[model samples]
Target: MRIHLDTGRSGEKLAAEWLSQRGYTILACNWKYGRKEIDIIASLDNILHFIEVKTRRGHGFGMPEEQVTRKKLKNIKTAAEAYLETFPQWRRVQFDIVSIIYAPGGHNIQLLEDIS
Candidate 1:
């Protein structure tokens, strides 16, 4: 469990850095609303993004993004609504997933946007 958590944290860090390099301004990390959590919240080109970060060592289970089920997306949406209630400046909102495959030598990352 600890290893799994560590890998998730590492992946989220990488995802944040990757998004920053691509002109996203990170607003929050691990932001929670009620019982739900948003792994990362960022803005780019005037659009607010709620991102879910999923990481895995390999494809033993499946691709990282494949783990984001409809229920997970619904949770993210619920959290995002709470976020907007606090800060309603964003007119355009998007849901995304940052999928990471953490290997020994290299890591594969992919961004799936507008998931919701």
Candidate 2:
């Protein structure tokens, strides 16, 4: 449990920096609506990106990207809708997944964009 928590935090930080490097402006991290959470919210090219970051130490269970199931997407979409109600100035909203896998050597990160 501790390992998972640590990896989640680390992955989020890394993802935020990666987004900045890509010229994305991060608006929020860990944005929540009710019981659900959107890992990151960023914008670039007039598109508001709702990102979900999944981090794992290995593929023993599965790849991180595989963790974003239909239920998760539904929750994220709901959360995004709720967010827009408060901040209604968004355009071209998109969904993305940042999958991080950390290993003995280093780490691997993949950004799968516009999954929604």
Candidate 3:
């Protein structure tokens, strides 16, 4: 059987729905600003959340959260700043990473929040 890696997109979709179920208003997904892309942008109670979604099949390689490097964090921060500039009314903001581990059988997916 052939297994294709569409982890990034799948993770983002899962994260968005997860947030929505918790009452977050999703403002954007896969938002691109120049060369940077934010996986999910959401707000709840006037607090903005900039999210990064990481997905892996298992720990055979490494944990999904381990993929976010310092440079990647820096880029996400810069992108958040740019996003904030466009919506200064946001009272608070936070950065979060959603780690998803999906099994090969398409079941037993687990989500870890704020891994960063």
Candidate 4:
């Protein structure tokens, strides 16, 4: 349980850096609404992004993005709605997923935008 938590935290950190390099300024990380959490929230081109970061040590189970289920998406959407209420300045919003595959040599990251 602890290992998974650690990996998730690490993946979120990596995702923040990756987004920063690509012109996204991270606003909040691990931000929550009720019981849901947004891994990374960023802004670019006047659009606010709510990101979910999934990490995996191997592909034996599946790709990181594959783990984002319908229920998870629903929760994320609800969380985004709540977040939007607090940050009304950001009228344009996007839902994104950052999948990280952490392996021996290095890590592979994939960003899927506008999932919502």
Off by over 4 Å in 2: none
Model 4: per-residue Cα lDDT over 1-116, one tens digit each: 99999999999999999999999999999899988988888999999999999999989889999989999999988998999898888879999999999999999999998987
Query: Residue 54's C-alpha lDDT in candidate 3?
Result: 82
Candidate 1: list runs displaced more than 4 Å: none
Greater-TM-score candidate between 3 and 4 = 4
> Can you write out model 2's per-residue Cα lDDT over 65-87, one digit (the tens) per residue?
99999999999999999999999
For 4-109, candidate 1 gives per-residue lDDT tens digits of 9899999999999999999999999999998899999999999999999999998898899989999999999999999999998889999999999978899998
Ranking by TM-score: 1, 4, 2, 3
Better of 1 and 2 by TM-score: 1
Candidate no. 4 TM-score = 0.96
Candidate 3: tens digits of C-alpha lDDT, residues 18-103 = 78998989999988889998989998888788888888777788888788899998888899899889989987788888777787
**Candidate with the larger TM-score of 1 and 3:** 1
lDDT, candidates in the order shown = 0.94, 0.94, 0.80, 0.92
Q: Which TM-score value belongs to model 1? A: 0.97
True-structure lDDT of candidate 4:
0.92
Per-model TM-score, in order, reads: 0.97, 0.95, 0.85, 0.96
Local lDDT at 14 for model 1: 94
